[model samples]
Target: MNVAAIETVPLFEYLEFEFLLEYDVFAPCDRGRTRVHEPPELFQGFLHCYYEDVYGTRPVTRELQKPLVWFSCGFDRPPSRDAVDRFLTDLEHVVDDVFDHLVE
Candidate 1:
């Protein structure tokens, strides 16, 4: 899937898109100063843009342009920083795998 490939593009190539993933404090699920609540499965946040690649004439085009994110936790009750870090790291790997498909 293109989603898996976005990360596969060499780090140099990825510089083309303006990648912006942030922990938004203003989303509905974001608690002001308390614990961040779990977003419903279908909740659409900034993260939704990433999957647009799945539905495109050229999925690779969408994957390269779209930004990926995980916006659930907040400063008050943030998810483990390491967990988020690892998720993104894994995502990068998946992107690489997906990229491999593109070349072949």
Candidate 2:
């Protein structure tokens, strides 16, 4: 199986920010190896980009296809100052947890 693309559809887009997720299954499989092609610009125009622009750096991505699972998340804007702080604080934890769970 092969995934051409994964679309993050916005479930809610308010003035504060946008919340999105993979609404459609881009790849389906009965059995066999599944391959997912990376998008051209994974973080373009997203809050992750914005954070990198403002904060000076983004998370270091570690690719692990051991079990062949891929996951990603992004934010467009924050509703409050606290939200911004929280995101910065929690980003590492989120990445670590994802890596730990997926690579295990």
Candidate 3:
């Protein structure tokens, strides 16, 4: 995902309160059933996610416009690599998207 695109959303909306959760999508995987890997800071800012759902109408599919409240405010702590991988793996939904139109 593009970092500049992620920064377009207003971060202040998420600064002191909770953001609303909207929709989700299942993403595609590698031949070995590998999962998407994202850096900790990737989860820190406004970003879009792509999910390739092998079981859905199509593969490498995506959901968009969902919002998430990052827990990094307390500390500069990032989610463990394993946890991040797992989250990406199980991301059968979109927390948000700034690119594509989000369809349920």
Residues 4-104 of candidate 2 have per-residue lDDT tens digits of 23233231122222111121222233475332321112222233334334342232121211111133233222123333333334344444543454346
Candidate 1 weakest ten by summed lDDT: 37-46
Please report how far candidate 2 places residue 11 from its true position, in Å. 15
Q: Candidate 2 vs candidate 3: which has greater TM-score?
A: 3
Which residue segments of model 3 deviate by more than 4 Å? Answer: 1-76, 93-104
Taking all chains together, each candidate's TM-score versus the true structure is 0.22, 0.25, 0.27
Residue 58 in model 1: lDDT: 39
Candidate 3 positional error at 3, Å: 14
TM-score of 1: 0.22
Question: What value does the lDDT take at residue 57 in candidate 1?
Answer: 24
Query: What TM-score does prediction 3 earn?
Result: 0.27
Residue-wise C-alpha lDDT for candidate 3, range 1-104, written one tens digit per residue: 33234332455334422212222222334455532333223333223232112232122111221222222212143334454444544443444451233232
Ranking by lDDT: 3, 1, 2
lDDT of 1 by residue, 1-104 (tens): 24444333333233322222222321333344432323221112213324433432233223323343222211123234333333344345445543454355
Q: Each candidate: what lDDT?
A: 0.31, 0.29, 0.31
Model 2 alpha-carbon drift over 4 Å, by segment: 1-47, 50-52, 56-78, 99-104
| Candidate 2 CA-lDDT value | 0.29
